[model samples]
Target: MHIKKAIERVPGGLMLIPLLLGACVHTFAPDAGKYFGSFTNGLMTGTVPILAVWFFCMGATINLKATGVVLKKSGTLVLTKILVAWVVAMIATRLLPPGGIQTGLFTGLSVLALVTAMDMTNGGLYAALMQQYGTQEEAGAFVLTSIESGPLVSMLILGATGVAVFEPRLFVGAVLPFLIGFALGNLDAELREFFGRCVHPLIPFFGFALGCSIDLGVIAKSGFTGVFVGLAVIVITGVPLILADKVIGGGNGTAGLAASSTAGAAVANPQIIGNMIPELKPMADSATAITATACLLTAILVPILTAMWARKYEMLRNKEQSAQAAPAQNPSSLAQDGHF
Candidate 1:
């Protein structure tokens, strides 16, 4: 059974396939992890730890000499994504109800859901896609996008005031493992090679763990409204990301598309932020469901879109290159054919 080969045939399949499998386990046997106990349970609940190690491995793969490029690419994507979400938040305040829509087909839609889904790029998904379709620098771009892992960015974008504030330590904590690996990797080439090898191997582990957190039922419960929010997220965030990648990040816009996905972690942000703001608490459950659906939807779609865009970009680039080389390679033939 060409299982590995089969998975590779599907875009983002290394990640998405495991994620789906895990979601199935969660949906059908929610207590399977507990029932099995020990390591099995750990794998079921090890998303954060697995991702932490993966981040370290990913950082190890980066050479410090190329840090500047990575920083620029990551920074461009991160800032553009956040800025877009902030602008949406400002508009949503006027357009959406304070308590979210409570009637009709769009009853559960809310600004919290919109912003949460819009603000954070699924770093793991972006990195996995970029590693397959982009440059090493582009793959390293997830280094900074990790900042969007929690509810802080959403809270800030949504104008959470008073006690809600950025915690410097949380930001530090987010990148510390990567930083440590980066330092060690730079200091010793052997360490870099050893740790870097672990990056790709770890993808499915965290993917499964990430999937375990999601209940596939949520998407169905949220229905078409959830699907609409998911598509809205891709379009609304994706266009700007693509343009930013071309104009600023110096790529063919594939990285931006990869970064436009909603993080699986973003599903929890609604409730976390809502707990702080009482008015939003009522909508948190709805927001969580929509965000989860968006997470799953984007996870499946962004990789496919990025893959398509990358292939098209590569074809266009090759065509241009061939066009430029034609005059140099076939000047005599051209002159004879054209009588120039």
Candidate 2:
């Protein structure tokens, strides 16, 4: 118990431990990555057989009202994600030369794209902003929520490119489930209700997959470039989000902090990039190897930054609120005293 608590105090103890364990298994045993690869591979290969539930769940989780509001208000952020990612891709292509980053940059972009594309986890913050600012229903708050949920796009684009994502394989996995769901959804309301109930519960199985593979020691071996990239992505990817927010009128540190935050394995990008540009597999692999390291590092930083940003925003907000109210209250109170 004491040892576990002590470990927890170390930064990224949870991630660090699992990464280490995975590496230890991979290194000492040597065949571990292969075995782990096999599992992920098998999952990818067999995924098409069972993906319907996931898609259904994904569809259901997207609340219709929120999604519609998000679409109307957040069209720009969504467009921004695609455009910025494309620009980054194009620049990477130009600078890489000859081989021109067929792999490394492609690999890194896939990883960065995940962070760039997502904002779902910010729902609570969006709700809080809406409540405090009296603009929940306003276009601004909806746009904010839309921005926060950008990762969905990142995952989709990256996955489509073959980031060990179940995308193409997903069709394979989802076929049966889709057929079943399609048939059931059409024929009987009860079955539709059943699928509605059943689909989302399986989403957390993805969490199990996350928990199972995350061994700590792999991070220890990641080295300096890995750490540098984490910081770099935080700065590089985060700057755009901040810039976008400022231009659109939602530029708070909270959104950027959250925007740069990441989760799951980012190494998947290499495989995705390699698939997109097969000529650069070596670079892609190098990038993939490094990015997983960076992701774990950044994931640790996210919550700390978010908490810090929120506190700062709150302090500023409170100060502003007090400043605005004081003049109005003071005069009225003075008039009341005079009357008395």
Candidate 3:
């Protein structure tokens, strides 16, 4: 049936497909998850355990021996993304109330949602876009971008912005599995490959479990606002990323534009963070739905935007090169015509 290929056809399908299925099960047969008792119910409801393992596997896939070029390319994008989110969050804290701004179209645009949407770039989408419109190093940059996949970065941004407070131990606990996996993987080559191979298959399992926590009704309420947040993410993060790519990464802005999308895993962050900080519990559901919508919207748009920008840059470069070569091509003719 070519199910994997078919899923690949959809934007962010690897995670999104399972998420939608879980949402359906949650919405239609809410009790089904509990009917099969411990195994089925536990697997369906136990998002934290599944995600913990996925994070471990994800960390194992990272190669610390990445070349300087890959590190620089990735480092610039990662730093710029996190910095932009931090700045936006700080601004929101100053301007908005503690609970967040509530307008008719968008009820709650809090630091939590903003940072959640802004902090992480979708590594898969960025790699795909860069492979088509950017340099090889840009695609390889996903190695570091994947490090931003979990709740750690969002928690950091929130804490830095004074939006939420987290304990030191909670921070350690959040990233402990990843750290362990990274250590073991780097220590043993065979362990790295074995665990790395397990990463992709675990994505759907955790994705579905994450989805079980979301309600489609909540998604409907936040859908339009989520679209707004998606566009805002691209522009808010895209501009600085473009400049950073040019200045620090020494490449065109395609890589920057490519890094502006929200990661699919980010849909789970609001809930995870909310559980940690009881104050954020009230906004978690809305934030998750909005973040999921934003992820989908950006996943569809970032690639198209990067391709268009690349084509424009290529055309301008070609025109300049042609202008430079014109004088060399017909120097004798230019002298005769006196145009040069």
lDDT of 3 by residue, 211-326 (tens): 88777887787888799899999999999999999999999888999999999988889989999999998888888878888899999999889989999999999999999888
Query: Candidate 3 — worst ten consecutive residues by lDDT sum?
Result: 100-109
Q: Over the full model, what C-alpha lDDT does candidate 2 score relative to the true structure?
A: 0.44
Cα lDDT tens digits, model 2, 100-135, are 223332333333333332222233333333344323
Q: Put down candidate 1 lDDT per residue, 1-340, tens digits, no spaces.
A: 9999998765456766787788789889999999999999999988767877877776676666658899999999999999998887778778877788877788688788889989999887898889999999999998777566556678677664222344566546656887788889889999999997897688788778766766776546666778898999899999999999999999989999999888766765775566566777778767877877787788889988989999998999999998988756477887989857
The stretch of ten residues in a row with the least summed lDDT in candidate 1 is 159-168
Show model 2 residue runs off by greater than 4 Å. Answer: 1-23, 32-60, 67-79, 97-222, 249-253, 272-277, 327-340
- lDDT (Cα, 0-100) at 337 in candidate 2: 88
- Residue-level error in angstroms, candidate 3, position 201: 1.1
Residue 147 in candidate 1, Cα distance off native in Å: 0.8
Candidate 1 CA-lDDT value:
0.80
Model 1 steric clash pairs: none
Which sections of candidate 1 miss by over 4 Å?
Answer: 1-66, 160-221, 327-340
Indicate the residue-level lDDT of 20 in model 3.
86
| Model 2, TM vs. native | 0.55
Q: How many clashes in candidate 2? A: 31
